[model samples]
Target: MTIHAVIFDFGGVLFDWSPHHLYRKLISDDHERQWFLDNICTQAWNTEQDAGRSLAEGTRSLIEQHPQHEHLIQAYYDRWHEMLPGPLSDGVAILEALHQADVPLFGLTNWSAETFPYARANYPFLRCFRDIVVSGELKLIKPDAAIYHASLRQVRAHLPDIQPEEVVFIDDVAGNIEAAMALGWQGIHHVSAQRTAARLRELGVGF
Candidate 1:
């Protein structure tokens, strides 16, 4: 099957998202800030929220384990928007270019449904995707075969002729790219916008 569409990841790819953005202000010491995120507010723990738990529940549960950092834990949800500085215009430009070329665009992201609204509300470009299967809403994250398959199934529903090999997946994480490739989709490991645009053209799938 010929490539028919491009799928993108939300954070790190289309937008600038980082906990350090929020923690930088809360913890002035760079090392201590890393320590806080590493030990106290770890990505593994946060993945639970991305797996569909509500912000209130995730925050309350963490506070129960580390009461001393309750204030900081709450701050994670309170100042969540601060973590997302803004969208990546370069990536947005690629998305627009593809959209203009009539290439179907889709999104598969590991974002908390609870916090996803902030992004959806702020990034109008997200409307470019024909569909976005959020991890929080699906309780499934990237590198998981289920989420990738779900995205394919959703796409197939709309474009019946589309096949697994007919999709090009763009993502920042190596693991996500590997997962998509394993499913037979062309994978672009997004390092920089310049490199990504070049890769797309090299694959003959560019706008």
Candidate 2:
């Protein structure tokens, strides 16, 4: 079936967000920085917050578990803005091009609802989407079929006739792509805007 709508994952695909952006400045030593990311403020731990745990609660709980790294734990959320510098220009260009073409656009992201306001406020490009289903707001995360279904529900509000086979889902995570594909949606594992744009063109989505 021809793809009629596009779904985007925000963090790695369109936004340049990384804890290393902040931690690199804080921890000079690469080894220690990697260690801190691995053991202390882990991806899994951060994902819990993205899945709807409050930032304050997550930070406080981690601090309690690792009292010695209280300062670092606190800094994780206290300086969270540092982790996101800006949008990826290439991806933003693609989004804008798609917008100009009047293609239906949507967002499905696993981002903390509490922190998402900052991005929504600062990033003008986010306004392009017909709707964005945030995992944090729904207390669900990527690779989970529930959140994908929720995104579909949101999309159906505007695109009542859209089918899973007619939607293209773009995500940086392979697992997220796989999940979407499982549900009969076209999937693009976005590694770069150039690649994603090329794939979109191949799928006949006009710029």
Candidate 3:
């Protein structure tokens, strides 16, 4: 079937989102860094936070776990913008090109509800998408089939006749691309804007 829609993953695909940036800014001591990773980084608290849990509630829960690191938690939350960079203008240009071609565009991102607006504000091209499915809003995360299905549902709501194979999903994470492919969607593991543009052109998607 001919490709009709294109889905893009927000974080690593368009913007450079680095957890190490947050860790470096928040944890100076090596011991504290290890502790933070053990108690906070990969914990269920973070999972819940990414799954629509309120920031204040997540912060409070973290503080309760490590009273001594309350200030650290506050600082990290206060300056969350430091973890993200501007969108790749080249990628946005390609997306805009696709948009002009009447190829429906959507964003599938695993972002916290509390921080999504901030990221969106920083990246104006985010508004160009026809639909956006944020994991946090649905209390789901990527690599989970539910989230993929949810994204499909959102697209289906608008273009009800669209088929899964008719959509192309682009992401920097191989795991996410794999997940999308599992759902019978075409998946592109984005390396660079130039490569992506070339791939899109090869797919007969006009620049």
Candidate 4:
């Protein structure tokens, strides 16, 4: 089927975000920092917040579990802004090109609702999307069919006639792309702006 719209994943794709951006300064020792990230501020733990656990609640629960690392745990969200340096310029350029071409755009991201507002305020390019389906707001996350269905609903709100096969989803995670493909949407596992752009071009997207 012909691609009619594009859905973007925020972090790692368009936005440069990583806990190491903040933890590197806090834990100068490379091994120690890696340990903290691997054990303390784990991706699985952070994904809980992305899946709708409130920052306050998740922080308090984690601190309770690891009282010794209270300060570091609190710092995860308190200084969360440090994790995001800025947008990935190359990907943003592609988005701008697609916008200029008048293709419908949407965002489907596994981001915490509380922190998403900060990103929205800082990134002016987010306005390019007609709508964004945030996982935290919906209590869902990527690699799960539910969120993709929710995203399709959001897309259909603006494009009443769009079909599942006519939309392309871009994400940095392989699992997320696989899930999208399983749901009948074209999936692009975005490694770089160049590759993503090439894939879009192959799909007959002018931009």
Q: Model 3 over residues 76-117: C-alpha lDDT tens digits?
A: 567778877567677778888887788889999888888998
TM-score of 2: 0.99
**Weakest 10 consecutive residues of candidate 3 by summed lDDT:** 38-47
Task: Say which prediction, candidate 1 or candidate 4, comes out ahead on TM-score.
Answer: 4
Worst 10 residues of 4 by lDDT: 1-10
User: What is the lDDT of every predicted structure here?
Assistant: 0.90, 0.95, 0.82, 0.95
lDDT of 4 by residue, 30-113 (tens): 999999999988999999999999999999999999999999999999999999989999999999899999999999999999
Per-prediction TM-score, please? 0.97, 0.99, 0.86, 0.99
lDDT of 1 at 194: 92
Find the number of clashing residue pairs for candidate 1: 0
Q: Clash pairs of candidate 3?
A: none
Residue 118's lDDT in candidate 2? 98
Instruction: Put down candidate 1 lDDT per residue, 117-167, tens digits, no spaces.
Output: 888898899888898889999989888999999999889877988888888
lDDT of 1 at 118: 85
Model 3 alpha-carbon drift over 4 Å, by segment: 22-39, 42-45
Cα displacement (angstroms), candidate 2, residue 130, comes to: 0.9
Candidate 3 Cα RMSD (Å): 2.5
Question: What is the per-residue lDDT of model 2 for residues 79-160, given as tens digits with 9 covering 90 to 100?
Answer: 9999999999999999999999999999999999999999999999999999999989999999999999999989899989
